[model samples]
Target chain A: MTLRIYIPCDAAAVSVGADEVADAIRTEISKRKLDATIVRNGTRGMLWLEPLVEIEEAGKRIGFGPIGIEDVPSLFETAAHPKALGDIAEIPYFKSQQRVTFARCGITDPLSVHDYEKLGGLAGLKKAIALTSADIVKMVTDSGLRGRGGAGFPTGIKWNTVAGTTAAQKYIVCNADEGDSGTFADRMLMEGDPFLLIEGMAIAGLAVGATKGFIYIRSEYPHAFAQMNRAIEIAYTKKILGANVLGSGKTFDLETRLGAGAYICGEETSLLESLEGRRGQVRAKPPLPALQGLFGKPTVINNVLSFAAVPTILAEGSAYYQEFGIGRSRGTMPIQLAGNIKQGGLIERAFGFSLKEIIEVYGGGTYTGRPVRAVQVGGPLGAYWPTHLFDTPFGYEEFAAKGGMIGHGGIVVFDDSVDLARQARFAMEFCAIESCGKCTPCRIGSTRGMETIDKIIKGEDVANNIELVRDLSEVMRDGSLCALGGLTPMPVLSALDHFPEDFTPAHQAAAE
Target chain B: MSQLPRKPTQKTEAGAYDLELVREIAASMKGLDGPLIPILHALNDRFGYVDDTAIPVVANVLNLSRAEVHGVVSFYHDFRHEPAKRHVLKICRAEACQSMGAEKLFAEVAAALGDSAQVTLEPVYCLGNCALSPSAMIDGKLYGRVSKEKALAEVRK
Candidate 1:
């Protein structure tokens, strides 16, 4: 009898030597003359225990991990006596969460359509084809699924508008431009499960009367691009994509377009500009993408996670999907836990999971083993939540009430070693470098904001400069074209609000 | 007086329309724009980056000094006057990477290649991999949380 073992080769896992672990497992198995086949699976998202290996036997997958090359000998022995490896289901990391969008992540062979089908992959698209466009839209709407690409806009409403639009050349665009510093969930999904995104886009196309789809992936994600391209080609060969998919007589063609490394291009309209071979400058909205997008035709644009989550919502039914989350925010979010954290990777859980549970418990606190001082929820534009506010639930409404957006569901933890003042400066400088320059407040104001920060840092008439920073921040926030300039001030202001001492000049006399 | 390159006196005849069309587009935008930034970007889009031949064409189109165009091209990092080799590798030399011991990685890379960050190694400000730390770009592919050993190994591959 041939036994099979699975190990993750996801980028995050690879970063922490998962490749070496896989190599070790292969070498050890071959050396021992063990009757086993090794399969490279995607990460289980429990990154802390990366190189997480799993054994498949008797239709059950047993997990063990954070294993290095050194653990191979022990793993082989454990494989001989399955009970020696301990109960995989009982692991705290695996048991303490609900996974929906990531249901097939580590369990199935990432590129295998057969494994995916066996594990419920395109069942949603199968169910979706039987329903009308409105019915499909309604199903998504009832699920309360919101856009996971930083902005928590309801996905259904956007779909409904596009579905209702009367255009001959409508489009479905998947924003795979996961440009966040600490987020790799989008990249992981694209690499690990490219078919899911392809299926999701196809479903969106069917629902919105779009026959064409494009995934505008960032140039930074070459692995994802290559994987997606290969997956798309495979999908076409398998009849999962291309004209008359699944023999339903519905035509949807999907292609991947590489972005030229502009952060602003992540924005929908700006992305459209870049797609059209123009400068990535934010366009005015009224005629949102739903009304007129991609060469002035109706378009349905969604984030990677949003579209990836679609198949589950359709196949499993909306009620089943909605039942997982807390009030208002429904379904599972593949939260990307990163930065100065011990346990980092994708954590898929429904809303109402506290930030503390993720950062402290799951993350095992900071990587330095120091207590986490502050955590930046969401991406660069996300707010810095000090230790006191760690109890905030990972939901759109809750985070918004606390003056933060669950932007791309990324949490970057920072230890006491981090200087908030420097972080604030970085936000301004980042905005300056990334701003498209079409808007004045974003382009010029960001530069001026950096200068003001320098003056305050230098302790040169700091009082007025501090005031000026605030004033300029407001102008940038109010006057900027898009979220690039608008939300750049969030981190800066939040850092200033939370850590005022960090901003004060070193030479300043102590106040009585 | 230095004689300028001969200007296209008339539109080319049939059978060479594609080249003529490109020349027409390049000639139309001559010297109208404020700086060479837009022209460089436009030409780069047409031919990946500004080539040796493009500089003269761009200068002729704009009726600007060749040295002036070259100066403008060199001023901005975005404007690559020379054609980048098949693959462009950019290593992050920003403060985040510096703090994360990228300096050691940088030195190792330099020593192995007989070139420093300033000379041959393309030291980029940041590739937005601050959280991952020690990031580098190989052929526009961003690899984060890299070490000297890992980088060297990747480069070898």
Candidate 2:
């Protein structure tokens, strides 16, 4: 009997030497003439344990991680190696997760459509193939599915608009241009389970009248690009994609396009502009993307998670997925726990979990072993929540009410040594750099805000500069054309609100 | 104090570019939906930077104005105007990396690699590997947990 060994080829795992571990395993197997089937799967999102290796033993997979080339030979001898963590499902970090979008990740060979299908892969698309287009749209709409892409727009409504629109051609644009710092769930999804994204996009095509799709991925994600392209090719061969999708006489084919390091391109309009081979400048709204998008056609532009969630929504029926989450937010969110976190990884859970639980329970506190001072939930534009505000629930409205966001579900932890003044300054600096230069408040105001923050830090007219910053942030929030300018104040103001001492002369003097 | 240096010639040295190669690269990628950005990226990949002279060639091939081509080249941060040194080191300067002491690591790396012509250090907002913070990318390959020692080794190599 041949033993099945699972090793991750996901970029995050590879970064920590998974590739070398794979190579060592291959060489050892060949050297020993051992009969083993090595599967290059995706990371389980337990990043601290990556280059996580798993071996199938009597229908159960045993896990070992932080594995190196030297540990490979030892892994073959016994599963009792120092790095071994017994069975994978038994691991508390993974056991706790209610993985919906990331279900196939770290469990199957990414490129193998066979492996994908066996793990309940194409059931949603299969169900989608049998349903009427209106029924499909209604299913998603009924699922209470909102856009997972920070904005929290209703996914089903966006599709319904495109479905109703009369056009010769429409497109399903998957915004894989995940530019947020603490976010990599999209990358993990694409690399680990590319077929899921393919199926989701295909379902989206069936839901809407769109026959074409495009995944605008960032150039930085080389691994995701290769995996998704390969998966698309395999999907085409299997009749999962192409003119007659699943022999249903429906046409929906899409290809991946690489974005050239423009953070603004994450915006749907800017993404459309870049997709058309122009500067990634944000276009004016009132012509929402659902009406006039992607070469002036009705396009459904959704984030990777939003699209990936569709397959499960269609497969298990809307009621099952809708039942999990709290408030208006439904389904599970793949929260990327990153930065100073001791157990940094992806945690997919229902919406009602508070910030305190996510950081203290799942994260195992900061990596530096210091008391956690602050945490930045969402992305670059998200607010910095001090420890006292840790009780804020993870729901979109809940977070928004507390002046925070669950942007792309990226939570970055920070320790006691952090200076929030520097963080506030960085927010303005980031906005200034990434702003598409289309709006004044985002472009010019960010630079001005940075200057004001600098003045506050210098203790020169601190009170006046703080007032000036508040004024500038208000204008940027209210007056900007897009969220780039609008929501940047979420971080700046939150940092100011929480860590006011960081800006004071007394605090600076004490630190010095 | 009328210092008359009439017009500071902003002309970049251009003769190093292969005009035929530029045409070939543009011609190969002409079928793509949005060919200009792809062609520029291909050109940037081949030559360390997009040559100023190649802009006219691309504009001519794509049948667009030189300004149109140049606008795109300047707009994207990844599209460098000048040739990169032998190596380029991008340190993650985003909030995640900051939480993990990237600023201190970045300063140390900059100081260690001070004024070295062979290597260039630039700050990237994020590289999407926040799980392992204080990450750096040396010539496109990402490294996590980029301690001062690891960064120095990578630079020195």
Where does model 2 sit among the CAPRI classes? Answer: acceptable
Report model 1's TM-score to 2 decimal places.
Answer: 0.83
Task: For candidate 2, give the lDDT.
Answer: 0.88
TM for every model, in the order presented, reads: 0.83, 0.96
Report the lDDT tens digits of candidate 1 across residue range A1-512: 89999887566566557778888888888899999998877767776666678888687777776676777788766445432345555667776777777777776778899988998889999999999999999999999999999888999999999998787799988898777666778888887787889889999998989998888887566567777877887788889887798989999888766665677889999887766545667898878989988888998989999999999999999999899888789999888777777767777888888898887778887767777788887777888889888888878899989888889987877777777777788788888888878789999999999988877887888889888998998999899889999999998888888888877887333220
User: Candidate 1's C-alpha lDDT?
Assistant: 0.76
Q: Which 10-residue span in candidate 1 chain A carries the lowest summed lDDT?
A: A78-87
Q: What DockQ, on C-alphas, does every prediction get?
A: 0.09, 0.32
lDDT of each residue in B14-127, candidate 2, tens digit only: 337798989997987777777888788777777778888999999999988999888888889988888888788999989899999999888988998899998889998788
Alpha-carbon runs more than 4 Å astray in model 2: B1-16
Which model scores highest in TM-score? 2
Across the candidates, what are chain A's individual TM-scores? Answer: 0.95, 0.99
Residue-wise lDDT of candidate 2 within A1-512, one digit each (tens)?
99899999888888888888999999988988989989999989999888899999899999988898988999878646898899998898899889989998999899988888899999999999999999999999988989998999989999999999999999999999999989999999999999999899999999888888889889888778778877887888898988899989999887888888989999889999998888999999979989999989999999999999999999999998899888899989999999999999999998888878888898999899999998898899999998888887789899889888888999999999988888999999999999999889999999999998988887889998999999999999999988899989999999889889999988766766
Poorest lDDT segment (10 consecutive residues) of candidate 2 chain B: B1-10
The list of candidate 1 runs beyond 4 A from truth reads A20-33, A58-64, A67-74, A77-87, A507-512, B1-157
- Model 1 C-alpha RMSD vs. true structure (Å) is 8.4
